[model samples]
Target: MLRMEILKLIRNNVVALIIAYILAMSIGINILSFGFDELAWVERWLPILTIFYVVILIDLLFWMAAMQISEDMETNMIQVMRTSRNVIQYFFSKHVLLLLFILVAAFLGIIPMADQFGFVLNFLYVTLVFSVVMIASGVLLAMIVKKQSVVMLAGSVVTGFIFAVMVRLVFPLWNISPIPFNPFEAFIKAYYYLYLPVEPPNQSYVALTLIAVLFYIISLYVFKKLTFDRGFRL
Candidate 1:
């Protein structure tokens, strides 16, 4: 079932196009930067990782969920599957596929710079947590909005807004202050607090992890409840 789900994504033209675009952009940037200064590759890795984390990762998960679930619901394929398989199996399959996609993309994006970064465990942990949060949010949004187009638009806007706010908080100017009680800001802060030189309160780590888990649990419950019926409204 997981194999089939992955194949379905492979056959999607939009997915293929997006993947190609990412690869081309990554390669092009690496080539252009390498020509200017061979020793400055390490400096390039941070921006690449940041772009992948803030935009590519979220966009990929959102579109994949929208395509896999929304399209299946639209065609009534989910209804057929539900007759034979439990909702948990279906949901788990989707989650597994999503994780696989994220892992593959992250591997591709990070491996080139891994030597320079020197295998940071904090980076890996933060990436895993961020992937879970984004995947859960994508699945939840896909369940709520059955239309792929709307999901794509809504996800882009929401992810962009969150990314912008978080980026501001991370690289704040002298006079700027991040919004108080911003969960996204806290999440990014916790990430940097763990890996970077900054020393945030220890509670930041606990709070971020708890928030990620909470979102995952909520997504799971919503998915199960919705799939219990006709498998999300079309």
Candidate 2:
């Protein structure tokens, strides 16, 4: 089921968009490097590519998945799939596939800048986990809200709030200096302390991951009781 969703998504324009965006970001970084110096370019551009812009791009994929799911319900496809064993697992698998797509796109986008920026495997792991959680949360929001527009609005608003409040405001205060191999420090502190050398992974990555996971789990429960009208009734 997951494989099917992934293959279908690859046929869409989203993949092309990701590739084009990555190319553009890389080119922009190089062009800026000649004018501003390598360190400045990393500070100004890398975070935009790796964190901010990446979030918006991945949100597009999330929206696509929501629309696809809604379409399936409208066409009775979901009802048909529901008859199968482990239907919820199949639904969740689609979210997993979308998350993987986001992560791969992000990594590939960052690859072009690695020579100047350096790469951290831990950053990739945290980013991957964060992407997965966002994808799941988006799906869950769509299922709960039922109305497409409302789902999107709710997801965006809630996600924005969490990013601004929880990830940005809260995590920085935590003390993880004493614990070596601290996963929290590995992810968030890297974003804060190691800003340029490797384009420090966003300090909010770990917090975002946790929030997304919690929302995803909550969405699953809501989806279990959801019923689709199949007539654009929303």
- Among these predicted structures, which one has the highest TM-score? 1
> Where is model 2 poorest over a 10-residue stretch in terms of lDDT?
176-185
- TM-scores for all candidates: the values are 0.77, 0.62
lDDT of model 1 at residue 190?
A: 50
lDDT string for model 2 (1-234, tens) is 666666666775645676687667656654554455457645665554455545555556656666556646556564546543443654666766766666666665455556644354555665666555556655665666665556556656544543453344233476423343322233333433434454444445456667656766766555554533232233
> Residue-wise lDDT of candidate 1 within 22-62, one digit each (tens)?
67756655555455435575463554444445345645665
Clashing pairs in 1: none
Q: Which candidate has the top score in lDDT?
A: 1
Model 1 misplacement above 4 A: 28-45, 48-55, 78-80, 116-118, 169-171, 174-182, 190-195, 198-206, 230-234
Instruction: Report the CA-based lDDT of candidate 1 relative to the real structure.
Output: 0.63
Q: Ten consecutive residues with minimal summed lDDT in candidate 1?
A: 46-55
